[model samples]
Target: MQVIATAGHVDHGKSTLVRALTGMEPDRWAEERRRGMTIDLGFAWTTLGAETVAFVDVPGHERFVTNMLAGIGPVPAAMIVVAADEGWMPQSAEHLAALDALGVRHGLLVVTRADLEDPSAATELAQAEIEQTSLGRIEAVAVSAVTGRGLPELRGALARLVAGLPPGQPGPVRLWVDRSFTIKGSGTVVTGTLAAGALRTGDELDLTGVAKPVRVRGLQSLGRSVGEVHAPARVAVNLRGVDKDTITRGAALLTPGRFLLSDLVDVRVHGDPVAGLPATLTLHLGSAAVPVRVRPLGADTARLRLGRALPLRIGDRALLRDPGRHHVAGGVTVLDVVPPGLTRRGAAAARALVLEQLDGVPDVAGELRRRKLIRGSELARTGVDTATFPAPVAGEWLADPAHWAVLQDRLRDEVERHAKENPLEPGAPVEALRHRLGLPDRALVEALVRAPLVTRGGRVSAGGPAVPGDLIRAVETAFEGLGPFAAPEANRLAELGLGPRQLGAAVRAGLVVQLAAGVVLRAGAPEQAVRRLAGLPQPFTLSEARQALDTSRRVAVPLLGLLDSTGVTQRGDDDRRTVVRG
Candidate 1:
């Protein structure tokens, strides 16, 4: 599906052409019909060949130019209507300027009411004027609704235009509300163009700047209910948990927890500021126009203080217009949704330099460094490839590689210092280390703990403390003359400077072999036990193996268990044991 907005001067027969083309009345309100003018956004759609094309009929009156902006902001293509009797006029220029400011490039001109006057000159004039704007060198069709002249060619041109449109924004859904009303049995319903992403029935959406979530009870696209809807289509959503008064024009139903809604936005200056706007100007963003205080940051950067928050992000384009003059001051490219306040000297200029680096494509690495972490959903809109991002910390979050490297080094040093401070204790407590590093995820901490620094039992240790030279020599002297199966008792082991932790460390470091609880032997005890067991019968009972090895069941059971664990022997199910061949 594709949507196209109508743009031109008032009394240009835009609404009349829509009725003639779609066979559906665009003037939905009785007052608008009586006044013979479109006061709000109107809707009409037609099937062109195998394609379905929707038209957003916008009012061209100066007073309703805002309504015109609302109609065209979310749609990609447009049709500029110009009455043949009256060539290009003042409102025509303003509408063209707004479209140019929005960067809308895929649209054509329609010379309506051609029967009243020679439309050849009007068509050429409109085409020449359009050539000066962003929408350069587009098609122009002179059509007369009264006589049905050129209607077929106009329809064909529209179909081709719809086919040539570029893909819309991608990712989680964003639907800007243009019209909100109530149904007798259905509750409040809102309508807008689904600018990006998908919306499904029963999907929860967040209203910008509002904490509570509203659910979609039902969804309709092109005036029909649908199970789900994707981008570049007109959507009507039946909302639950909110009333028509609660949501109005400029409110957006967005993918919850994805967009950053802030009242202050920093942007890069676009085309020249026409009319040199006042301190306050109106900001026109996707279907929403609100007042803001403008502060120039530098030659190409500025800050806008909005009255309420709008769900904005990097690389979004907006129009800065003077509400009183009803003309555009300039266009703004959103560089930051949340910018720091200028409370000190040279801060604004410093921020301006930062914004200068952020041009057509966003500075993703720099943003990640400044903000530390950005949500995975929002990162898709940043125009920066995550695969190219420096040293991302995790899949769900983005972090700068240089920043992560510095943090990794800092943590290693902290752990080393901790080990030095408490030589007798295990490395550092997991919770304490996390606090010291000021990091939230344990995976980040573990990723940096390399080599000699190891994490075991929820604690980080720097190689388990130097091995206490005296204790090592004492253990060696005590076990020198002992037999292979001879073991030291718990009391004797403790006397040799080997408590539970130290004894466990010794076994880990291969200094001693722990055959059983309260009975540890020299390091070569396991091989001696294996060699003695090999001499026994192929399948032997525990008592037979113990007697042959000249050891009690205490040392024999654990030793056999260890041998079996290492594939040295196999324990039978029937109170017997056998050697494992391989």
Candidate 2:
């Protein structure tokens, strides 16, 4: 929603359309201006009605597809500018395919050069070609930036296209520096669309892929200094501590912990160029391009050895192509970068692995909902926007309907299992249950426990009579054997070797009561202790009771309180007195 990249074959009026819309030409490079063609990405933006849209004008020359891709890679939407006079071209096909394959959802096809020809003819041809792919009824309009023809329609079409986009959510601010340089008074200024979250002046941010942090001393949007900016806004960020010579395109200015850097990655390669790639190629992720050595696992399977380290993660889509050819050999979902080489082989197994990790929701909104209860780290690993990952609260992934059902049933079973094994325990410890589940996402376990389950004290054992039969028997036996005495403290029960965990479970089961000072008592022990105290002959001190019970004072005070509270004994000035007769 932040930026839209324009792509098509060169001479397609992409730059001209941008110029017409924004009244500022995107071809800012002097060489580009001299050549009358865009060889690199150009930047511009304009406002339409209530919305502001930014443009990343990419070169359409086949020789510059890499540059074009770099320009468009961060944009969620795009303007597939097809020159109306020439209709669809080769690079247009590649650009459209790349956008589709890379998963750019919100977009409209702009058939520019309306004044030069029957514009609808170009629109019709472009529409027919796009129908063959998954673009799903591309909304296209014909316009000529030179004649100011159809400009109004182009703006309105873009507004409608952007209307349905998911609103941006606040996250770690990241600006992939597509352009960086120095201006006379500004020091080092790097510009890129706000790819993720908010950036404010004087904010301390790290220049990742580098060793030090850069502070934002100033910010400019559309050439005007601004105090703060949010995602999708194109801005030039002025940095402190970073020199123009020290930084370049591909360096990302971001909040710490928002992303990671790596080199090696596992990926599923689609459309491999050759039977096997040569041992080397270039890896393009975000705006950073680095050389890598390719090791083919199979016709489409491979491991890439990057020439240098780069920040990457699982589920991040990166295009691997021949650096020399500058043609996309294939694209892959990064399973791991700086990851241990996959020890397994076979395309079937690897493909299955990739499919399994896909959140499997049909759309962004669905994915967001499905991942709602997912942990932030896990969502990052999946490379899905955390905001889109559905969950009731922030920082949690929403469970897929099917997965949620399975989780609920599993939790119920696990809680019951805990209750059964340690009937004396009050409930399962939430943390303990999470460990037991061993879910890849730990947050899901926490969410499951937080809702629909009662948490008392710190334990997460079963909330009710979910205790197992065998555990119940073990607890009952322990209780009967310890009659008239306090039930063994948790550690004492643990000494019997059922384990501290199982004993804690028994405590949660309500078969036993845990006293404040680590004492464990059978549920009925208080009544029995009271009955025993009522039969004691005389008022006694702690020592007398200790001797009579043949136990330490640790056992006497609680026992006396247990009895006295149950009408079994009464407290006197210095000793305990019994209340007789039922």
Which regions of candidate 1 fall more than 4 Å away from where they truly are? 167-170, 273-277, 340-344, 360-366, 369-395, 416-443, 456-461, 466-582
Q: Please give each candidate's TM-score.
A: 0.75, 0.60
Candidate 1, 404-459: lDDT as tens digits: 77877887888879867754455777778878888777766776687778887677
lDDT of each: 0.81, 0.71
Q: Which ten residues in a row have the lowest lDDT in candidate 1?
A: 380-389
lDDT of 1: 0.81
Candidate 2's TM-score: 0.60
Worst 10 residues of 2 by lDDT: 359-368
Q: Look at candidate 2 and tell me the lDDT of residue 224.
A: 85
Model 1 CA lDDT for position 379 = 66
